[model samples]
Target: MSNLISGRLPAGVRPQSYTLDLFVQLAEKTFSGRLLISLKVEKSLQTITLHALDLIVTETQLCGQEALVSIHPSDETMTLTFPETIPPGEQQLSLAFSGKLNQQMRGLYATEVQGETFAFTQFEATDARRMFPCFDEPAIKARFKVSLNVPTHLTALSNMPIVEEKKVGNLKKVTFDETPLMSTYLLAVAIARLEKREIRVGETAVAVWTLAEQVSLGSFALKVTQAVLPLLNDYFDLPCPTPKLDLVCVPDFAMGAMENWGAIFFRDACLLLDENRSSTATQRRVADVITHEIVHQWFGNLVTMHWWDDLWLNESFATWLACKIVDQWRPEWDFWLSFQEGKAVPLALDALENSRAIQADVKNAAEIEEMFDALTYEKGGACLRMIENFLGESVFREGIRRYIKQFQYQNASADDLWTTLERSSAQPLKKIAKDWFTRPGFPLIKIKTSGDTLKTLHLSQQRFTGKKTGTDLNPWIIPMTLKYEDDESIHEQHILMDKQEMDLTLPVQGSLKWIYGNASEAGFYRTAYEGRTAKALSEFAAKALHPIEKIGYLGDLWALSSRGDHPISVFMEALCHFRGDASRVLVSEICSYLEILSRQIVLPADHSRFAAFVDQQLTPLWKKCGWDADKDEDDEKRLVRADLLWALGSIAQDEEILSELPRRQTLYQARPHSIDASLVGTLIRLCALSDGGKRFDQFIEKLERSKTPEQRDHYLLALATFNKPALACKLIDLCLSNKMRAQDI
Candidate 1:
């Protein structure tokens, strides 16, 4: 290959369509393929270059003549040098190549389940080159026609449904229908001995595929899809992109899920649910993962991102919209409250000195991989939520609908989306949203009152960093809301804070109890209240604030205290005000914060004091919920019970919880399903930690009998919790051995 030094391929020729035929040999772990690509040559040239990695090309033919091929490993490109200069017109390039079915969970890989080998593909973020030779960039959209030859007993799946199948001796050739114009990264294929459970959502055929023994485990996922698919269709104002949709649960997957056009791939843990064994958290996770991938069929598959730099446009929209759809479907689950707690992760990451922008300039494969972090998914989603709250939900929904309709089956940039939204709402969006998209950090709003009555509020904004920096920072155009309680009633005021500092005078008849910025936890910024205001808000938060707002309040204070903006004592003092709160979301957050403090901050000499403090806060709630789940209890109570059990047994070291572990373990051993599914894992871990080497063999026996993926995970994690040094070493060796799946290791 010619020594091209650029990170991206030269753009003289583009692929219009591809016809790929492959013979997969699962036993030998290798595959051979012939690729016929229809190309549109933009300029007359003697040579053409495209991406290929770890593949051997046996033959190359162009225009019915032999073409010279050279492979460049440095840039993962294959160059074709023709005998004569090709004209600027349509042409066909043919190549026969072979590659190994890699063990790595990317490209075309092999995974073993129940002593059977299956081949799967994961080609996003530049791994498509590892699978086949092609223009493996997101902007080069092309139609694909794929045909796979596999053993007769195996089933073949791709981006489209199988159009034809023919048996030839012991092998079968499966040809899929041609796909819509799409990016190469969205192409997928699977060959496995699989069984599927199918259903119809509107005119679209939907199925969940799994191994035969686990086929029944997909019932919950099927139910979730049956509800979520039509909701998204109506919301987007479009039909499903493809006639059929398949959600496949693979034994080995690198990510939570991959939205590969019509065929999505998920890890078994993310897709399968054992109703008798899986916890409420697992059910919630299954719904979230399924909904997230389905949303991609419209946002990321139908309307693709132009390049890697705009990856957030595809991922953030899917992340934000999935939460919206799932919350609507299961409002009783209080899903948005969980979302408010989840935002704390990205907010903390953004406060660091080395944080990257929501939209960073990606130059190479490594940079592209770096883009798939908390900043892109969590922070980006939070930014979109802030925008939606500002623009009004209906107005934002209309703008998104227009965006998808305008750019379906094509590539678009972040600017294209912003422009479409601006036109839909007739609002100036680009200027207000530019900093959030391009800047590295978020703003921290500090409040100060001028008058003794506290009606006149002065707010200032600056870039918040975990550590001090000398660089000058630019101001963000913030959409803010203040929720305050006066003597008469609660009131909300909305403002667009575009300047460095702004002042507002509240019109109140009586004294104002408190003013809370970041109302409803909608904005993507942190709020810092003055001393007396912070105290009063914390004292009255249960009565005055929504559950979601309470989570946001605690999360912000926890983050600020961790970064040394305030003392740890301040957060500890605030925790005392919520002792009797019944919201599971708030209680769970409090437990998590206390656990972290116990592990990372409390001194050994003062550990008992801290444990006593935790017991004082959670014991009454634990007594109310009890160790066993009540038949008439709500999901929130069950979840809160699980959280409290974990905190008391693991962190607080409460003697009542510790002494009851043996009895709980005995009861679980007697009848596994009799124990509360949500608390089983916590009980196992605590028992293992408390019993140590005495019951190691018994725990091992229980692990060997584990049937579901969730059970296996709980056992494996419990095995690691044993406090003996010898047991720890044994666990290390067990992980290094071939007994466990790569994902578990």
Candidate 2:
């Protein structure tokens, strides 16, 4: 048995394909399976070891000959020792195994919806062995043919389209076509009474599946995929490999979505969208989530990663590409800025000190699971953006197309991609990629500009430690860009800062109104200004600048302030300019930052002063949106108003807002449908915060009597807001004790 957990399978034998036939007993919460594995032996071997977990192997055979099976449950493996040596040649191994369908969401698990039981599978980064034993590592890619026997009333789905089905009395046996060569982690299955909404894109058939009652809500997701998949195909210059793509919404999903080769599974919250009742934010999220999973059809599923260490290669590319595609699909959403604010900035902040690199080292199952974090998704995308901006998008896309064509249906490492990109762009991409991907921290660029007559820009780089002192860490190959004040010739200068400090000759004019370092926030590094450049940024931010630039400046300012490089007052002064900023995303971000400072950092004695500051800053927005929803308000206006109300009413503890909640609560309970859907959550929370245990009990009763999912969720959140530990514990027990539905859990 292999000793390394979640590592590569031994090199002597390689699996070519798997044929699995399973009988699923939903009532028993168990499954029995027979698997035939085709293999190619590189050397003569007396024994072969394969991964299997929580399963009882009844018998084993090699090439139709009985073999001795020794099980080592600790290593999740079973070793079969043949009496005679198996020579280097093609061979087949077969096994009959049975395992319980556990409740843990890791492997094949069953959930009860209403009164019926449904089974689903989630096996990423290591849990596939529990489903059906085979070579479970990412490098061992193979074709899969799956057949399942279940009750005749249920429908079964796999990674490929259904090829055949037969019924015997009360059970149906369903078979799926052979899937493309892929890793075991991408294999998925769901057995339920699923209703599907279908669409066609060229030769490909796409469908969105959910419960029968929620089938109508799946239309928005289907529409999104139909509109975006073709654009992605055009962008990649490559077609999806499968003829059918099935998107299923499961009630209990571990993550937002899984990028299975052909069958993608999403949480109900992410996939189901009712256009009439959904907000603008909900629409944007649905688009982003669907686009992200679809792009993975090519980027992640077609061209695979060799190991878990380079998992970022799949996630980061998809993260950036999702926004790139969505921006083209819906320009009014301003997805690029959303990407910067949501992904890039937060990741940069997370990568300050003691943060993992883009390409992390994963040794065990737990480490591999933990690697699917912000560094891999957000920072990884930011670094990719940095590379793309430096290499030019045309060249970047060209290289990507070549890379996909070269490594289709195979596993490749980060270097394989860098080398391919180097071929197209003729840049030192391998060096640039290694410096950022291997390091644990990000660089902070400090630019010092002096002399009005002839300005000289001295730029220095160091690892940002969130402290005042600098660390002796290795420098990065920064693809840093600088934009001067409105001179086309000097508008942009691309520099690769390989050393600690370098001097550049800037063509000075007048007093240098502004200098945009990390221009357009293209680079992943933070920038700090000194001398006249600092003054220029302050003045320009106060008067004229794009909303994105304002976001970038404020983000960098807050990051620097956290590191003691700048004062908190500087951030406050910069934020004052956004008092009248109409961009909903930006306004929400400002409100979030204020709440963070007040809740996480400020002392108890300073609460009154902090509340006053928040009230003053948000008063402009409050005046615009008002306490109640205006007649026929814009979608963005409604979203901004709800967010502001949550911040001001709850976090800021506004007395007038708190005072009005009891009246609103009584009115809402009398006529629940009359209250605005957008502000009802805030009203519930305020009700709990204003009146303690009595309001909480009332909210719980409201939750029990609620008919709709939205109101139930709101009431649950309000019930969770109680400050008393005993009450919080009671709410926790109610959630975990199975009193709520599985979907709610």
Candidate 3:
């Protein structure tokens, strides 16, 4: 582990000669208040003789950045006088500032969500510099001793476990358990009007806290947190580390959740739930998110990262671990399979795209947060699954044990992990590590059924291998898992297999049930089953497989379907088989593919036949869930269904439904304010074709001038297909020059 604190500094962190090291935070809030700062370097080692200290601070906000407000100098320490009545050398001095948080920014800033007022902190960026200063980088680890003073009723929380809580008059003061020295971003929390609940996970007492006003939502979070904790404790081979754990909801939060040692921060929907009518999707989300943050307490909070370049190593493991645990414990939810289609495939494609590489350093700060994209979360997880495949489960678990034991509470790089595994297994891991981490795309593993013997092989594009052979061949450290029907077995082994089209003999006889080439979904290799082997996987997915594999089964079909290489009937048959209670996102993705086929394939040949086939595909499913076109259901669900209806109605020429779409569009567009929704575009596009040029122009004018973030997506869609794409394009340009929201996604 390199220096998360002392490594390359961010912009403005280091000035020409002076340096600032941010440490220590004291929350002196009345209901709501904050502190932000960094310590500055004043005297040189050669000049001071380790005697007196002299430092200056400037561009300041609130308090000074010293560890203690007033420190008595020892015989070995130094002191300096201020140029002004209350100053010293302003150039290099420790500075800490305190203030009431601005609600708009949520953390250091404030945020207002729905109709209720809720305040929480989301200071992961340079805002931590604004909150409290000490070496702010992740590598610059330091033990944190945080103290808070709030209204007697306002509960105080931090990364550390609470050691003391005292009520003095109307104000309550709390001192927390000291945190293992860690980076700034990992230290998170929220202070507000709260209603809380608690449970015991083993010997540790854990709690769920949220806005008092959100009673039903907060209660649901309490259950999910309590249930997932013990299960994870068993799987990870680590007990819940903190004596007390806290999960708090901030509706206005920018990210889903922050792993703050004992205190984790989350967005509203993730931690808060509606008991009576929450959709199936909402329930699955609660599980996935809660499990994700809890795992981070071990992976991210305990074992850290040395630099931002390997940030994916942190996120990808948590993601894979989260979905895996959820699927094992709550198989009914079937969330991982859904993720395979909507999230994983798209990520693999993006990772292979011209602009991206699997492992690259942060070029500049402008795109750091934005860098947390599809590749980091999806493709990275797939790649790690591959690593598990090659290493073998028993050895892989041991490697993790050694890796974490060696680096607990300290930061680590990808190489640090690779070295640990090499030492543990006495095998050269560099070849496989380089192939997976240093490349730009995924690999295609081809499995064929030849006579009674099943043969397997590997293929990749020229760029990935950097090869000059006729087949552009180069060896890859392939980690593959296989599922076959003839054996009724799932081979979760890492095939350190190398070849330029070398065939392999297998133990299979009749057919193959499935092939998880990268066992445990670890690697980024996609499987291609030839002829009859593909048929058996479909049959297994059709009957025996659960939601996760069904989604993967559909994803495999869709990949082949989109390339126009697979037959439409075979694709349709696979879609027909996915009747499980998948996710709304999965259902929506499937519906989209069918509609795309109708518009691009079937419709052009014979419009009436296409319409009939689409109506056939959608009609039964339409009434099955969200076809309340008359608006007689939940708002969020209605909106989700409305998305599907627009596609169906537009293609079928259902003018009755399509004509009223503008009014529905207007209603959806009109939210808490104009900027609260992204529905304007689809509604506008449906109107464009339904009412021709007249309604299109009226809708166009509204978007042309509307300035809220609500209009951004609509404007973008309008920009994509309008009479003049450039007109919409230029307006987007203007908006770009204007401010953008951090929560637009």
Candidate 4:
């Protein structure tokens, strides 16, 4: 078996830089490449090994001298054994190889868009071996100079700006500028008949590209890119490394976006927005995704992780910073509330017995693929935000500036970041953050009040799990922030809970009513209290708490209720009390949790009764948001309206909604463009719930006539919303036919 633990190349050799010359034949779906990689040899060795897969190594040379080459196809590697032991020094290894472009979306692949095939690459998490022969690990960061030969009709792009392009006999030879020191996974290339819209922000040139017919939809991405780059440059306190940035909307992309140095690649859905058809929510997503990829240009591309094990270091900062930056850009969106909702995901997922730690063990390719999960992205980001809250935003910002400055153009580990923050804040981060990173599960802080005066507070923690898994893991160093009953002081009791139990004696016990931990929903843990305490906090959540805190209270109640640690009545009571006061995000989270409880917890025989309960719980929100038509509504209104309608249609199955389906279907057919963009999906789902075989056929017709990418996505989602078994079966059969696009399917 191969060395799965490290996944490292053999000792005695390391790559410094690579010079690649590639000839891509789009029609034949194949490419031939010549590579000359400079290496820093440390010790004398007979054989040099590097990662390469699915490529025919035609020739090899060591130190410009002939060498015998051997290929290990099963292990995705190659070895060149020279006639004698190579001396330690700088040396060049030359190779010539050819490989077919893969249909699989990994590595150098061919994607057909509108009947025209285009070549693209996705090499993150060890797939770079499928592209060329090299040391493909993240720490082996190297500068790359690439040259591509493509048909004259196509435009070629890479990780760097094009330095030279010329036509020769119906073919174009495109040479890109040498890239900064970056990982092989960040290396990218695309050759297609594309169009771009460009803008200039400061000295940096930004451009967004897409298919020729959809170039107009690229404007929104371009606008956001121009706005966020300068803001990010200012925030990181580091100048943009590259003079130009390019974002390409690939017709078929496995991930939302790949931050490939200067040239970022995005799935079309994430980057394109048609003003006529897309909703305010779609625009927000476009901005968020664009800002995310651009921030990666600094965090992930400029200063990368030292190894795949520290991949969370690359994702977490970008994810958190994207929310922060977008919130700053649009304060009205209340993005932090949405951020709180996003943070709740990891808390719930990590509480499970099967969940992984943030820094997951990626011993092999399969494990590496799984690391890009909720824990790494959501939990990691939440941890950073919690640290920010504790250390103060100004101090955290300074730490980030120092981190980028210290590790610019170099790989850094998780400890490097903590060390930098500790330096900035002069706080003991290592002690507080160690368990958070190393431990596999999150903690639940239990609160109980005792003493004759009911003023004594007791707090303890144990690993949280769905089943009774027992307390096997050690306690976490939780950063707890608590607010007492009716105490409006911003500087409440903040403690670093390094032990299993903590007891605090209140100075005055006369009227202390309740205490809540992890206030503002900043920390990545759950909290529960004793009977009287939980009830008091539940009531407090109904009136005095911040919206995020209320959301947190509801979430913890649901978790405790589901585990039977707390009564489900407590959850329902809190939902009823907070319904009118909850924000759009809280409403959305409530609906989401109720949906899960209905599916998993509610008995099959009690499904109807549970649905009625949900209808009653959501009634306040439905009345507040209302079912009405309005123009020029804000994103919050749009989102809230959609969520309420969805809960009403799916859970309640109200007769009014069922009766209106036919009329709504007619309106959708006659003036589909006039339907509220946010409610379109909900309306289609209502139709599906109402015996929608005929409506399904009409949706297919609309899908065929979709003029914008957003319309296509909406139609596809509508088709997928069929709940009826027969309709779902028919939808699957339709997907197998030629009508559906492979990417959409």
Per-candidate RMSD, Å: 1.4, 2.4, 9.3, 2.1
Pairs of colliding residues, candidate 2 = none
Predict model 3's lDDT versus the native: 0.57
| Candidate 4 residue lDDT tens string, 686-707 | 7766665667887888888887
List residue ranges in candidate 1 displaced over 4 A.
Answer: 1-6, 468-472
lDDT, candidate 2, at 218: 88
Q: Candidate 1, after superposition: displacement of residue 682 in Å?
A: 1.0
Q: State the C-alpha lDDT per candidate.
A: 0.88, 0.82, 0.57, 0.82
TM-score to native of every candidate shown:
0.98, 0.95, 0.69, 0.96
C-alpha lDDT of candidate 2 relative to the true structure: 0.82
lDDT of 2 at 583: 75
- Shift in Å, residue 105, candidate 1: 0.8
Model 2, 385-419: lDDT tens per residue?
98999999999999999999999999999999999
Better of 3 and 4 by lDDT: 4
On TM-score, the candidate that comes out on top is 1
lDDT minimum window of 10 residues, candidate 4: 485-494
lDDT of 1 by residue, 463-581 (tens): 88776441435778998888998889999888898888888899866878888898889999888888777777877886889888888888778777877878988888878878878
lDDT of 1 at 184: 96
Ranking by TM-score: 1, 4, 2, 3
Ten consecutive residues with minimal summed lDDT in candidate 2?
483-492
